[model samples]
Target: MLNMRTKAVWGLLALALSAGSVQAAEPEVTDARLSLLPGDSPGAGYFNITNTSDEPLTLVGAESAAFHMTEMHVSTTENDMARMESVEKVDVAPGESFAFAPKGYHLMFMHRAEPLEQGDEVDVLLHFENQPELPVTFTVVAPGSM
Candidate 1:
């Protein structure tokens, strides 16, 4: 036996709480950077992605305004030789973090439209399998700095 006004108030409160929880469950990206070479060579990007929610997060692809193509790659050494391979997706477990570093998981930026110099910033968008597109800015750094 609840009044109409009381029911409306309760409904609004529930909606607000749900919205807050959704925001809190989103993943976080940090320490993003793009390595700049001296010439028109392909650059690499690194970052740390942290999943804060209970569910796993999957990154399917990435896009950048400075390059024609962005791809995920991983470096491995076999028989004393190092090689890189393209990766389709990367997964992060709940409450865990995925690191993109030198000689590890990284993003390959190819076919650059313009030259990138040190201290420049590039805007990149990360596509997720289940989450919304996350926008990130990567600072251009030297090749050896990781």
Candidate 2:
């Protein structure tokens, strides 16, 4: 009851989906998640990075087409005052966890790259000092999200 052309089309689609699933489970990328704020006017981005490999990892830097400049920042507090400072690298030990959040380690987007509507997405690539850059597609979310 099925035509040859139709079966071929279905096979192609299934192959494509399978390839994507394999890439998602690739070894290079371990645990990674990112979230952003709403009404983007100089808003920050949060990333939770987990190294599943046996070696250590150092976050070299980040870049985004959406922003004029992207930098890795670390927050500090002294005498009830808090400030952020740009850093060259962030480290993660084997099987360790690193967090980039408000009032802590985070990424600063100098300018809005794309529309900040919910469900919108941005392609951001993160480079590790010793590892190859990993490109991630992040979905835009409202402020104070997971």
Candidate 3:
């Protein structure tokens, strides 16, 4: 009986340790918004994501039913000219945060499937490397609001 008790204790301890080692908090997203342009122009998405987990996270891309194609982009200036370039991935270290804002890292939502108006809510699924996709709700706003 004593031997059985010792084995059970050891098993419980191992289980607890494993659980503690692998435990991580979910990533937090805030201020998610999508700026829509008139006509067939591509929309822009902005948000702030905080990595609350124990490991690093990489943002790969995004998808939304409102748009046919969503891509990650970064805006920069060179020789007094503004330039926007596509980015494949963005890494955020543990306890760090990344912002998708105007004039910086942002999402380019192209080819709208349907007409969207101001105050409408858009559902965007953010893809990450080695992590499950994160669903975020973005409120549509006018381009001038950004």
Candidate 4:
């Protein structure tokens, strides 16, 4: 009986340790939307990513079936001129949030793979370093809305 109790206690301790090592929560994405341009022009995507995990994560890029190419970019005004440059990655610390808004860090979706219109929904997969790809749905909106 003593040996059996000891084994049970050890088993419970292992189980507790495993649970503690598990990630508490996955990252949360909110306010996902896309600014769809008219005709065959490229569009832009915006959203907010909240890092709920215990460690920092890097957002590398994004992919979507609606677009053939997707890249991370940042828009800035330099010397009275607007400039848009490609960004390699963005880091979000634990318990922090990152925004992909207008004139800020955003996803540049180019080369449409399919037809899209306003009010349509598209699936986008956000790639991260050292973490699983996060799936987000973006609603198409007018370019002027944004």
Query: Which candidate should be chosen as best, given TM-score against the real structure?
Result: 4
lDDT of 1 by residue, 32-139 (tens): 999978787899999999999898899999999899999999999999999999999999999999999999999999999887899999999999998889999999
Relative to the true structure, candidate 3 reaches a TM of 0.89
Distance from true position, residue 143, model 3, in Å? 1.2
Better of 3 and 4 by TM-score: 4
lDDT of 4 by residue, 1-146 (tens): 99999999999999999999886478899999999878889898999999998898889989999899999999999999999999999999999999999999999999998999999999999999888898999999997988
Q: Give the residue spans of candidate 1 off by over 4 A.
A: 1-24
Query: What is the lDDT for 71 in model 2?
Result: 86
lDDT of each: 0.93, 0.72, 0.94, 0.93
User: Where is model 1 poorest over a 10-residue stretch in terms of lDDT?
Assistant: 19-28
lDDT digits (tens) for residues 1-146 of candidate 3: 99999999999999999988974677899999999988989999999999999799999999999899999999998999999999999999999999999999999999999999999999999999989899999999998998
Candidate 2 Cα deviation (angstroms), residue 16: 32
Can you tell me which runs of candidate 4 are displaced by over 4 Å? 1-5, 12-17
lDDT of 2 by residue, 103-136 (tens): 7887776777666666677777888875768887
Any residue pairs clashing in model 3, and if so which? none
Q: Count the backbone clashes (under 3 Å) in each candidate.
A: 0, 1, 0, 0
The Cα error of candidate 4 at residue 48, in Å, is: 0.5
Q: 18 in model 1: Cα distance from truth in Å?
A: 4.4
